[model samples]
Structures are given as C-alpha cells and as structure tokens.
Target chain A: MSVLGRVRARPQATAGVALTLPVAVFFVVFWLVPFLAAIYLSFTDYEMAGTPNWIGLANYERMFADPGFLNSAWITVVYTVCTVVPTIVLALLVAVPLSRPGRLNRWLRALVMIPAVMPLAATSMVWVIIYSDRGLANTLLGLVGIDPQSWLTSSDLAIWALVVMVVWKSMGLFVIILTAGLQALPGEVYEAAAIDGSGAVTTFTRITLPLLRRTLLFVLVISVAGSMQAFVPAFLLTGGGPADATQVLPYYIWANAFPYEHMGYAAAMGMVLLAAMVIVSALQFGFLKGGDE
Target chain B: MRAGTILRAVWLIVAVGFMLLPVYAMLVVASAPDDTDLRGLVFNGFHLPENIGLLFGEGNLPTYLRNSLILCVGTGVLDVIFSAAAGYAMAQLSFPGRRVLFALVIGTLALTPMVLVIPVFLIVKELGWVNTFQGMMVPGMISAFGVFLVRQFALGIPKELLMAARVDGAGEFRIFARIAAPLLKPALITLFLVHFLAQWDNLLWPLIVANEQELWPLPVGLANFQSEVGITYHLTTTAALVTAVPPFILMVALQRYYVAGLTFGGLKR
Candidate 1:
C-alpha cells in the first residue's frame, strides 16, 4: 500500500492504537521492570544505602549455607504437602457425595463457601480461641477423657495449628472448584460401573477418579502455590514461632525486607522462591502431562 | 437409590454442620455475657449489646470501621476503573505488542506483594505516600487479577457492538461508559467484592503502610486491639464478630453473583 493510503487508513486504527501505549507502559514499569529488577537485585548487594555492588553468587551461597533458610525451605515443603493433598482429597470426598442434585445438597454446597469469604485474620483469631488451652478443642477433648493439648503455643503442635487453619480457611474454595468438577462429570459412567456390579468404592476408584484428573491438577497447583506463600494466619497466630516452626519462606522474606531492611538479600530469597515455584510447577505440569499420555 | 439418597443426605448434613460450626461459634461466643466464660460451644445471649457497645463506646471501633470503609471502597473504585480501562483496551484494542502486554498482565498474578513488600514500601516511601491513604489505595489500584478478570469478561462482547457504536460516531470512551461499562456490571461487581473483601481483610500491607491508629483498617486495628488493650476473650471475640459483619452481609447479599464470580475466577486461571 502507498504511504497516503496507509495514512488515510489511520483513522480506523485510532481506537485500538491509542490504548496500547498506557497499558504497555504499565506492563513495562510495574510488572516487567519489578520482576527483572528482582532478578537482577538478587545477584547484587543493592541495599538502599549503597550502590548495588555486583557480588556474584554470594547471596545464594549464604542462602544455601544458612541453617534458618534451610529450615524454612523444608518447613515450606512440608506445609505445602500437608495443606494441598488433604484439602483436595477431603474436598473431593465431600464434594462427590454433595454433587447430587437436591435442595439440601445445594444448601450444603453454598454453605461451604462461607469459609472462603471469612476474613483470614478474624478466622485465625477464632481458631486461636478454639485451639486455646481452655478453648473449644480442649473442651471437646475433655469430653472424650483426653487431656487438653497446647495447640498453638507448642513447637511440636504450632505448625500443625497453622496447617489446620490453612486447610479450613482454603478448603471452601477447593470444595467449590471440585464440586463444579463433580457436577460436570458424566453420570453414565457411574451408572455403567454400577451395572457392571461394581461397588461404591470400586466405581469411584475406577471411574470418577480418572475423569477428575484435570480438576485435581488445577487444585493441586493452586493449593501448592497458595500454601507456599501463606502469610496471614501464620503472621497473625504464630508470629513465625514457637521456635520458628511455622516460619515459611514468605515470612522470611517479609521479615528480612521490611523489618531488617536487607532488601537485596531478601530479593535474592524472593527470586529463589519464584524460581523454586516455577521449576516445581513446571515439573509437576510435565509429570502430569506425561502421566496423562 | 434409596440407600444412595440416604447416604447423600447424611453427607450433606455433616458438611453443612461442620461448615457452620465456626461461624455459629463466633456468633455464639460474641453473644455470651462478658463475665461468663465461653469455654464451651453453646450459644449465649445478653452480650451482643454489651460487646457492641464496648467496641463503639470509645470511638476506637468506629474509627477502625470508618478507615476500613474508606480503604475498601477506595480500593474497589480505583481498581475497578483502571482495570476496566486497561481490560477494555486489551480486549477491544489491537495495538502493537498486545500479546506481550496481556502476557505481562497475566504474569503479574504469579508475582505477589509478599515478595515485593519491601520494594513496594521503598516506592511508597519515595512517593511520600507512607502512612497515607494514597499509599494504601494507589499501590493496590493496579491489580493484575482484576485486569485479567475484566479483560476475560470483556473479550466475550462482540466486535459488532463496538463497530455499530462507532458507525453512529460514538467515541471510544463514550462506548465504554455507555455500553461496555453497563454490560460489564456483573463482572465489575465480582471484581469489586473480591477486591473490597481483600482490602477489608488485609493486614500486613495496611500494618506496614499505616502506622497511625486513625489510619489503621480493621485487621490491623484488631491486631493492635489484642496486643495493646486489656486482653479479654469477650472483647476480642466482640471485635472479631464486628469485623466479620460487613463481609458476611456482602457475601450473603451477593451470594449468586459471588458464586458466579468464584466460578469465573477459579476456572479462568
């Protein structure tokens, strides 16, 4: 096309063309820049005071060698595993039965969403009350003739308190997601399994489980991602210790960056987190895909 | 069929029972008389008025409520408008590097403020927005999740609508305001509620940003309530119950929209 033709056609390009710059700018400065800067800062000593000295691999070397960092990393993995697996499985166990079409089932499914909307701080406070030595859990345990457990204050049990809170807080979303998956499954498969004289467990194991892989995968990824970055309940309830038991990596980053002002080192840890998440997720996705094939 | 129905009925009851317990416990504990020890799960009365009075009596709770209202509403309005503008552009506009732009928006979801809390604080410090309303609202205004959500919803609108509006000489902004905005109401409300609740319940950011008592939102205020005040289970529960009321009402009133939003939100990723 001639230059004049292209110039004359410019009027048509006006609408879509105008919006591109501002959106592109936001993407560059806020999203892309911060991310790349995080990566670059990870490799340097860029504390706010001094020029960001380029220190090759020292921060990472320290990270690997640091006992506290290693502990938190291990705790993060455990926390992720405990929270994600049971939340998905338990949600599915609850959802599949509740997926049946009925008024009561509808009510139950809707009721499950209450937890997801409850403010995390409030819920954690409530859990603190419930798990207190004199709280509801102990009261119940007393009814069963078992002694009260110090749920949140003890090192051995503090992280489990965190795990319980996370599971309860996040389980509602999983229920909603997996229930939708449950509702979408073909009824004929279940009917066919029944006709084949398969029992309830057999039908669920042989039929329903296989069909729900994608939803399960989605739940797994979100749960893992969410748990790895869990902040509210831990921050509120445990304060990252009864001896640093509940101190996950995000908490470490928060403390180092905000409280301690080790911005560059914290940035290094954040990069490590980001890389760990992406690599782990990519591997999981690949493994799941391979399994499906 | 009969056995299966019985089993399903039993399961539903159990699930609902479990789900309602904590909420029921919250209300029950809140309503218990101040001097009475609410060590058990049983519900009580006569304490609602007393506890509520305690919360609002000295104007402390009222201040927290007001701050929460300002932050939540401000964040909602700012997030929705910017997200709509950016989303509409992404969906309707065919500008250069559009793919890269959209990719960047989606990419931000994977990167959360937890990792960048310090850097963000630095940015807020540089802008002199620390311990200020602008600091709280402005930084959160550009949520990637909000933009991504609105853009996905906006993409469903037919181009013919925009073309027809253009044929009538309607300006881009006008079409968006008159046509696209109204059409995107459901998604807007969804995003609004999500962001509002998120901000309403937010702790770390608000705690980090707003150091003053007057500027503190409910979560931070409540946190301080436990620490600074004379700690009583009754008063704490009262504060917790009061904190939950706004979001509870919002979730109930917008139940249908909330469910649809959750479906769109959860599955969209």
Candidate 2:
C-alpha cells in the first residue's frame, strides 16, 4: 500500500494523533519542560545574572534549616485550616437552602456567587479598604460598641483578616458545587427519612453527611490545595505583613526567587509545596475512601 | 411550612448581603468625593464617572486594560481551540499514546501554576519572551482543566456521525469542524469563560514577567495604583472597579455556564 493509503486505512489512529498534537506539543513545551526545569533548578544555584551551578541537595538542606521556610510552613497550615474549614461549612450552610428549585433561590445563589467571580486583586483592594482602621470592619465594630482596631497592621489579626477575604472569595464556588451535589441526591431517601419521622438535623447528620462524603472530599482537597499556594491576597493586601505574619508558602517562594535572588531555594520550596499538596490530597482520598465501608 | 419558607428566604438574603457588602462598599468608596473619609462614604456620593475618568486620565490604566483584553481574549480563544481539538481526539479517536496523554493532562491539573512560577519564569526568560505579550499569554493558553472539560463534553458526541462522515470520505479536520465543533458549543463557551476569567484575574505571573507600564494587566496595574495613589480611596477603588467590571459582567450574564464550568471538575469525579 502507498503511504497515504496506509494512513487512510486507519482514520481514527491518524486523525487522533494529528488532532492531539497541538495540545501535546503545547503541554510539553509549557508544562512538562517547566516542571522538570523546576525540579532541576531546585538542585542548582542559579542567580538570574549567571548560569546555574549544580549544588546537589544543598538547597533542600538549607530550606530545612531556614527560619523563613519554617515560618511560612506554619502559616500555610494555619491559613489553609482557617480558610478551608469555614469555606466548606459556610458553603454547606448556604447551599442547602439555595439548592431548592425556584427562581428566587437561583437569583440568590447567583448573588452569593458574585464574590467568587470577582478578580482577587481587585477584591483584595476592596478588602484593604475594609480592613483599614477607618474601614467598614472597624466601623461595624464600633456599632457593636467595640473600639476601632487596626486589622491588617496587627500581626495577630493580619492572617485572620486574610482568611476572611479568602473565604468570601472562595466559598461561593463550593456552595455551587455542594448545591449541585445536593440536587443530585436521591429524593427517595429524604422521603423515607421523613416517613420514618426523622427530623431535619437528624436526617442531615445521619444521611446527608454520609451520602455527600465524596463531594465533601472533593471540596476539601480543592480548598486545601488552593489555600496552601495562595499568594495574590497576601502579596497585594499585606505584602507578607508587618512581621511576616501572612507570609504563606507561595509568597515566601516568590520573595526568595525574585527579591532575594534565591532561585534554587525558591524552587526547592516549590517542590515542598507540590509534595505537601500531594500528601494532603492523598490523605483526604484515603480517609474518605476508608469511610465508604 | 410558612415559617420554614421565611427562614430560608432570610438566610439567603443574609448570605447574599454578606457576599455583596464588600462590592457595595467598593462602589461607595469608588464614587465618593476624593477627600471623603470611609465613615462619611455611605453610598451617598455619586461620582463614579469622574473617578473612572481620573483613573484612566492620570494613570496607565487604559493601557493596562488594553493589554489585559489582549491577554484574556488571546488566552480564551487559544484555550478553546486547542482544548476542543485535543478533547475531540481523546474522546472519539483510537490512537496510540492516548492514555498516557490523558494521564499527563490530568497530572498537570493537580500541579497549580503558583508552584511552577519560578521555573516557568526562567523558561520564558530563556525564550526571550519577558515583557512581551507572548510571555503573558502563552503559558496560560492551554490549561489542563479546559482540555478535561472539553473531553468530557466531547464524549457525548455520537460516534456513528463521525463514522458516517468518514465513510463519505470527509477529512478528519472537516468532520471535527463541521460536526464536533458545533455540538461542543456549550462546553466551549464554558471553557472560554473560565479561561478568560482566570487570565483576567491573574496577577502574580504578569507581575513577574511584565515590568513595563504598557505590559501591565489590570490586576498588576491596580496593585501599582495602590502604591502610587497612596491612600486615595476614590481613585484606588475606582481603578479596582474598572478591573473588576469585565469578569463581573461575564459572570452575571453567563451565570449558568460559569457555574457549570466552576463545578465541572468536582461533580464529574
């Protein structure tokens, strides 16, 4: 057979290969190459001004001893827990009622989701205003008969302030997700529970929670992964804060790579972040799957 | 039952209010008189146009907006096209390396761009694309999420249709363009909006790659405005409002598709 005939004989194989080439090529150049380069760079000392020199795990050792890395790791855990837990709970609280079928509920759901769609940088700017001493937060505090307090400037409160903004920005998406999960649930189960004289709280705890475990796990994994690498809010709003209180992992990596010229160290930190995310996701999957029985 | 209905309504209203308060506060500050204090600015002033004008007039916000548009539109179009083509192949065609490619794409989905910033920047610098539009747009062009979304939608396309086209001696590309592309409109729209919003809101990558005023996108531009304008709430909030307008309009207009896109990955699993 001629080459054209040979190729034409299996249209699926030829066309599939041809069609997949663009994304494959792009992914290789953009993602694969960069990913491997990050791994390689983590082991080398590459100042922007010069060629990289292989240093072989020195960067990793330095990170283990680095106070900034330790601070950022601690902050990452705190930030992730603060943002992820509230986002899941608040989203669930709002999504359950909004999941009901009605035009008004749909509109209300859209309204609540508006913040999730806003540009984080812009929203962070709004938050900077809100968290300012004279901003609405303090004003609202005054309404409650409390003293006006500096929010972002206070080390103890800066990370918490960021947590509030992140939850506002992120929870809506989870709400939508959980709402979908709620809608997908079998109505027959709820009907059975009602016939059995199960109360709302009892049905939710005994049935709804267990049934929605997979969806909840999905939300948990995504939220935790996102919060671990959060950068823009901390950078734009706090600039890593008054005493580095809000210096999460990604911010620390950025500061090292750009401002401090510690490219190897930064890449090493990125590897750590990648590992942390994988571990967290794996743990969630394992725990959730174990509960299936 | 009546009490339950009222409680649900109240809960939703409170949630929506909490969600919108920051946005509403932003609008109030953006429209307030320049020297007004935050306490005094209680959605009373109506100087939105003037503040917007000042934002574009005194700063490089217009340039930033233009650059951002180019970046977002470019990323969106390319992401859609690339994802559709690849997704169609993965979903319909039988090819070698298909499984491995899908796995690779899925793997990339787990690796957030934030973790790859330093190496990606190095790659861009190596390619001589720093401070260039390509630098800002290319790495963001083909997200694994877009590919996965398109592939899932493409799986629903009837295989017989493609076979019939093949029997009629239609070209593969022609079959995709004539059949698959039209059928994948909803998914394509979802991918486009998601990619557009992502590119529009992206800050850190652009901040690193583009240092020139003309190359700055809205997010970076808004960040710089904070430093340059000091504590001028009117101008800063005005700039932020402008930065937010595109995605906000998109979300409001295409809420269904946008939400579908948001929940696509989660629900599919």
Candidate 3:
C-alpha cells in the first residue's frame, strides 16, 4: 500500500489541496465571482431588478458626460495626490530620526500608530466636532492668532481639512514601515559616505534613497491604493459636502449604489477606480524601477 | 549621537503631541456633561459612565457592540486559519496545482476589493445572506494579503523539520495541526489582530446590507447617529472612546505581535 501510494502523486499532495481548498473556494466565490460579476454588471443595467439589460459601453460612456461622476473622478484624483504625497513625506521625516536604535524610538513607534487604529467612523465624529465653529479648530486658531476657517463647511477647505486628518491617520504606519526599511540598509555604505565628508542631504539623496527604493515603492503603492479607497472620512465627516468638494469617487459610487439605486452605474465607476489603482501602482513600479540591480 | 539627535527628540515630541491630542480631546469631551460648553477643553464632570450608560440605554449600543464583537471574532479567527492553512500548503507541501492556487492568491492582490463591493453584495443577497452575520463575515474571511504574509512566514520554517516529521509517519494534517500551526504562532497572532482591526472598522458593506438598525455594527451605527443628528456630542465622544479604548489596550499589550507583522513579510492591511 505504501509502495502503491508512493507510485501515485505523493500522498501529502492531497493535504496541500485540502489545505488550499478553503481559501481557493473563498477566492472564487467571493473574489473571482464578484470580480467577473462586476465586469459583467458594468456592461448591464441591473438596478436590483428582474433582468440585467445589456447595454455595451453605455455606462462607461455616460461616466464622461455625467457632471457628478466627472466631479467625483476629479476629487478622487485630488484626494489621492494630496493625501499620498504628504503621508509619504511626513512619514519619511518621522522615520529618519526614529529609525535610530533607542527605547524612546521603540515606544514612540507604537504611539504614532494610535490614530491609524481608530475606527474611521468614530474618529470622523471627533473631526466633525473639531471642525465645528465653536470646536477645537477655532480654539486652536485663537491660540495661534489665526482666524478660524470653517473647515468642513467651506468648499475650498473641506477636502483639504479631510486631507490633513487623513494624513495624520495614515502617516504613522508608513513611519514605522519606513523606519524598519531605513534600519535594514547596509551600514558600511553610510560609514564610507561619512569618511568622504558627505553632507546629510547628499548622503540621503545619493546613498539612502536608491537603497530604499523597494520599501518606498511598497509604501507608495499602499498609500496610493489606500487614498483611492478612502470613503469613511468623506462619508461620515463631510457627507460629500456643502458642495461636492469632498465627494471622492468611492463616495460617489456609494451614493449611486444605494441612495440613487444606480447599481450598474456604480459598478462601472468602481471598475474605473479599480483600473486607476492598477495603473497607479504600475506607474509607481515603473517610475521607481531605477537602475538598481 | 547623530547630528540631529537633540533635534530628533524635539521633532518626535511634537509629533507625539499631534498624535495624542485627539485622544486627549476624546477623553475630555467624552467625560463632560451633555450640552456643555464646547468652546473650552475641560471636563464638565466625570460623566463618562453616565454617557456610556446612555449608549447602553437608548443608543442601542449593546447590540452594536455585540455585533461588532462577533463580526471581528468570526472574521479574525477564520482569516487566520484559512490564510495559514493555504499558506502552509503553498510553502511546505508538494501539491499538484500549487502554482495555480498561488496564482489565484496573486490575482486577488491585483484587484481592489472596493470595486467588488457591489457584486459581492449582490451575490450575498442572491444567496439569501443579506442582513445576516454570515453575509458580512463570509465574503471577507480570506484575505490574499493574509495568505501571502503567512506563506512568507511559513517559508522560514526549515524544510528538514517537515521532512523529518513526514519520515516519522505522522499524517500530514496531524503534523500541520500539532507542529506547523504551533510554529506559525507570531504570524497567526498578527493575522488575527490585523483582521480583528479591519473587521471592527468595517463600515461600507455592513452599511448597505444591514439597512436595519438592529443589525448595525458600531461604525454603521455611529455613522447613522452622526448623519441623522440623533446622537449627542457626549455619546459620540463616549462611543469614540468606547471604540478606541479596546484597541489601544490591545495594542499596548501586544505591541510585539503588531511589530511582528511588519517584521514578518510586508503590510498585512
């Protein structure tokens, strides 16, 4: 029996298939099915109704002329760029110093991660109060000797207010990640650079950045993807706004999906967003794929 | 010391201040009396218990808390198992279609889950799972990121150890249950905590599927209260505190597991 079993595909192979089967089933039913369905649904007008009417490319075409969709597409782009840039930069700033080996840096690493752990819906309430007229915004402004701007209510500042809050929420995790990445770089190179009398900026730009490309690329992809899917803040804090200033694509898509019952339309927009994530991630890869071995 | 050592301490102190200011504000407002002066940052009274009682009383918060707990546990426990099992197989075993299965996991990574929300909802509804716990928990039980993280961690397990176990005539499932699973402790804990956090913060799917208040989790319930202007500042702050305090405690207690996630493979979020 042992010889016969050995002659066949390894007896342990069944265990592998059995072990992998659950996630595979989940991937198919939840991931693959929905993915294919999203693609198919984007092409049809299903609206939670009897039958999905096939109208090839119509929803995608309508997205262009639709002002709401257009505004949201633009807002999403703005939100992604604004949030991603500051998060990476600020996180890098905090990371560079905190990367040093010390008990303070170690403990501070967890301290910085606090906001990232807050429930977005819960934190949005706090921000609503902060951005309110008589709330912390005005009080803080009073201390700083600057007038309080209506943060969320003002169309001009609403998105930026949310951007600032999100940068706070996001920057910490990246700080920790970047800190680890910085710690992992070869130490001898820094020693060589120090011997050459290299300045801080010079060593960073010349030696550190190139070595840190993979981590930065990883961080960039994560930040970009996360920023694009940011819905809770806008949904809970701004309600897509005094105008549609804060109506990110996900917000707009949610609006269409539930409130307006534009399921097919939302799916189409979602597909576009998915494509945007893929493209942006690819671009980050390509752009950062410098002449490193 | 490095050139910026003193400067670095000052920088981090300010950043910590920024990081903690909201939590402090939450503590202050959460403990204050309802309809108190919102202009100043001071405690009106130590009414945190009273405010929390309000949530437990009329806010329907107990239900929300219970649902959130169940959702987090269900998803977290399942994600750890499914991910670890699948990851173990891919890393350690010789399977017929290992490459194909691994490719499937990779394929999931390329697609954004946000986009699939509609179709996933629709499918769940079709399965008669709308407004059900299973509906919310099942769709997200397995994360590709979780699978990849587990696989990365599992790859570090010595090949000879598994081979030795096999040579000793132990069944594959038994060896995995008794040996491999125990060895993957840090990865498992990390996966659990990460999924727990994600599930606790899950709002969007539950928002649509759980249209009824009875089924709403804290995130959805909190959003509902805020959106409709029904929830008070005290209750909002209290709920924020209530939601945040658990994770803060968890984080402080298990800082090692959280950091272990970063050290393991990559971002598990």
The C-alpha RMSD in Å for every predicted model, in order, reads 2.6, 2.2, 2.5
The 10-residue segment with the lowest total lDDT in model 2 chain A: A3-12
TM-score of the B chain in model 1? 0.93
Q: CA shift at A37, candidate 1, in angstroms?
A: 3.0
Best by DockQ: 2
Tens-place lDDT per residue, model 3, A1-293, is 68855843476788989999988888999888889999998999979766789999999999999999999989998999999998898888888878878998878876777876777777887877777887877898999899978989899999999998898788777887888789888899999999999988999899988888778878888889888998899988889996999999999999998888788988999999998888888878788874565
Q: lDDT of each prediction vs. the true structure?
A: 0.79, 0.87, 0.84
Question: Per-residue lDDT for A11-83 in model 2, tens only?
Answer: 7788889989989998888888889999999999987778899999999999889898999999999999989
Where's the lowest-lDDT run of ten residues in candidate 3 chain B?
B260-269
- Order the candidates by TM-score, highest first — what do you get? 2, 3, 1
Model 1: CAPRI class: medium
lDDT of 2 by residue, B1-269 (tens): 78989898998899878878888888888888774567533776599998787776776888889999999999899899989999999998888899999998999988967658888898898899999999998888899998999999999999888878877889888999999999999999999999999889899889999989889998888888857744487678888888888998888888889878877766675
Off by over 4 Å in 1: A1-13, A17-24, A46-51, A186-199, A291-293, B265-269
- Model 1: per-residue Cα lDDT over A152-230, one tens digit each: 8899999888887788777888888788877778888878887889988887887787787777777777788888888
CA shift of B92, model 2, Å: 1.0
Better DockQ candidate (1, 3) = 3
Model 2 has an lDDT value of 0.87
Question: In candidate 3, residue A145 scores what lDDT?
Answer: 98
Error of 1 at B30 (Å): 1.5
